[model samples]
Target: MNITVVGTGYVGLVTGIAFAEVGHEVICLDVDEIKVAKLRQGNTPIYEPGLESYLIRNIEANRLAFTTVPTQAFAEADVIFIAVGTPERKDGSADLSYIEAACRTVAEEIRHSTVVVIKSTVPVGTNECLETMMNTISLHSIHVVSVPEFLREGQALSDTFQADRIVIGAQDAHSSELVRSIYEPFERPIFLTDRRSAELIKYGANAFLATKISFINEIANLCDELGANVDDVASGMGMDQRIGRSFLRAGIGYGGSCFPKDTKALVQIAGDVTHDFKLLKSVIEVNNTQRHRLVAMAKAHFGSLIGLRVAVLGLSFKPNTDDMREAASLVIIDELLESGAHVVAYDPVAQSQAKRILSPTVEYANSVTEAIDQADACLLVTEWDEIVDTPVDVYCKLMKNPVLFDGRNCYSLDEVKQSTLTYYSIGRNDIIHAYT
Candidate 1:
């Protein structure tokens, strides 16, 4: 299949590269000239594990190409995927201006009949609306299908190749079959659904996952008050067949391109239909407060955060990615700084990316030890391998006051028992020292 993907963000780049890896001739189209130039040289704009390697190998094999010209990208393509970003608006609805612009480009460029696939996340009924809009604007017949992507950041390549199931939503069987043939090489389970359902599925999955995360964080909060361990509670609950653990790991909150946007968008989606989504509203509420919980804990422990040297371990929302879109560190650091704490943060890969959004008052450190050195207390934010794998003694030795506020619950209480470090974690009993 001759495929062209619009947008070169996490979704578009991964979708294009994965298709080429499966032996398809794919041309990824982005409006950015510099990004296309880099992709032509087998370079990727984003940092996803193993994605750059796949991009390079497929380009080397002549199965993949990149272009900024719409006509050149869409002229020879059998299928065109609209993978542009639908960012969240202030009203919590997805802003489809990018999706609209991409549609207009495809409408103006395509020379032949094409099966247009929407791999981008959008509101329900958006597929039908886009399909109608494109067909109205063009002379050529355009068949749009909703094939929303389910790939995760940091593991996009693996998720694409080893997807649990594929959802195909099309108004016509021919368009659906054509889209199915493209994925036939992967041998994954395919679900046939209507366009609206398919669009809802993408938001529903992310919202549910976000729900699980918020639910666990709430439990973790109760555990903190009740003197119970959330790890044990989650483990026992997860043993049930219906409640298998995935996003059950209790932490600050979920943040990335997807969850924060999708959940808020879903709430707005519900509002569009005049339905009040009360539960999801609280989920978002809990998460917003959860991000600043560590600061509150620090305030209670010490008299004040003023004049304190705080070390923030991990800056990204999650590990193995440089995405800080809705990262906890953004809020956590803000609250710390507002409380007059001197912040020093570190992440293996996200420091440079974070510098753009983080405050200048927040200092960056090269390594975990470097960030911890001379700090009054440590706060574990993202639980990256470099941050989580560090020994308990490292904190005890490096910190000025040997106090640890672990938001991710990375270290065990037994490990802290042997050290003089004061450990403060979410939903767990703290190991405190007597001195101020």
Candidate 2:
């Protein structure tokens, strides 16, 4: 199959590369000339694990290509995937301008019958509207199928190859079958449903996952008040077969391109239908407040952040990807700096990307030791391997005050109990240094 994937962002790039890896000829289309040039030179613009290697190998085998010209890529393609970003608007709705433009281009450029697969996360009824628009504009008949991607960052390749189930949503059986055939190479269960249900599936899954994180964080907060350990609580709860644990870890809260945007968009989707989503609204509120909890913990310890030097570890939302969108570190660092603290931050791979959004006043450190050296307190934001594997005693040796705030619960209470540093973590008892 000749596949043309529009918008070479995370979803687009991964989709195109994965298809090409499965013996399909794929052309990844992006409007950015520089990005296209970089892809052509076997360079990936993003930092997803195992993506660059597979991209390079597929390109070498002539199975994958990249282009900025939409007409050339779409002309003879059998499947066109709209994998553009659906960023959340101020009102919490998904901004579909990019999807509209991509569909318009596909409608105008395609020369024959093509199955248009929407891999981008959009609001419900988007595919039906797109099909109407494509049929109206195109000379040939177009079949628009909703095939929302479920790949996770840092593990995109594994998720693609080993997906639990594939959902193919189309109005017509022919379109559904055609899309299903494309995934025949991967022996995964395929679910066929209407476009509306499929669209809601993606949003619903993210919202529920976000809810789980918020629920655990709330539980962790209560545990903190009761002097109970969240780790043991989560472990005991996870033993139940009905409630298998995945997003049960209590942290600074969920962040990334998906949960924050999708949860808000789903809330707005409910509003459009005149349904008030109060539970989801509270979930969003809890997540927002959870990010600030670490900052408050720091302030309580120091009495005043003024003239203090704070060390921050991990700037990315999560480890293995250099994405800083909605990262807890951003809010924590901003609050720390506003209180007149000198901030030094470190991440294994995200420092460069972090510099773009973070204040120029904050200093960047190359290593954990450098970031924590002579700092008044240290905050572990992202649980990157480098930060997690560092010796607990290093905090005692490096920081001026030796106070550590573990937002991700990277260290165990037993380990912190043996250390001389004052330790604070979510949903756990604070380990105060004897001298502090």
Q: Which candidate is the best by lDDT?
A: 2
RMSD of 1: 1.6
Candidates in order have lDDT scores of 0.90, 0.91
Q: What is the lDDT of residue 420 in candidate 2?
A: 86
The worst-scoring run of ten residues by lDDT in candidate 1 lies at 427-436
Global fold similarity of model 1 (TM-score) = 0.98
Using Cα atoms with residue i matched to residue i, what is each candidate's TM-score against the true structure? 0.98, 0.98
Candidate 1 per-residue C-alpha lDDT over 34-150 given as tens digits, one digit per residue, 9 for 90 to 100: 999998997889999888889889999999999888888988899999899999999999999999999988998888888899998999999899989999999999989999999
- For residue 55, model 2's alpha carbon misses the true position, in angstroms, by 0.7
Residues 1-436 of candidate 2: C-alpha lDDT, one tens digit per residue: 8889998999999999999999999998999999999999989999998788899999999999999887889877888989999898999899999999999999898889889999999999999999999999999999899999998888898999999899989999998888898899888889999999999999999999899899999999988888787888888898888887788999999889999999999999999999999999999999999999888998888889998989999998999999998889989999999999999999999989988898999999889999999999999999999899999999999888899888999998789898887888888764443112
Give the per-residue Cα lDDT of candidate 2 at 330. 88
Clashing pairs in 1: none
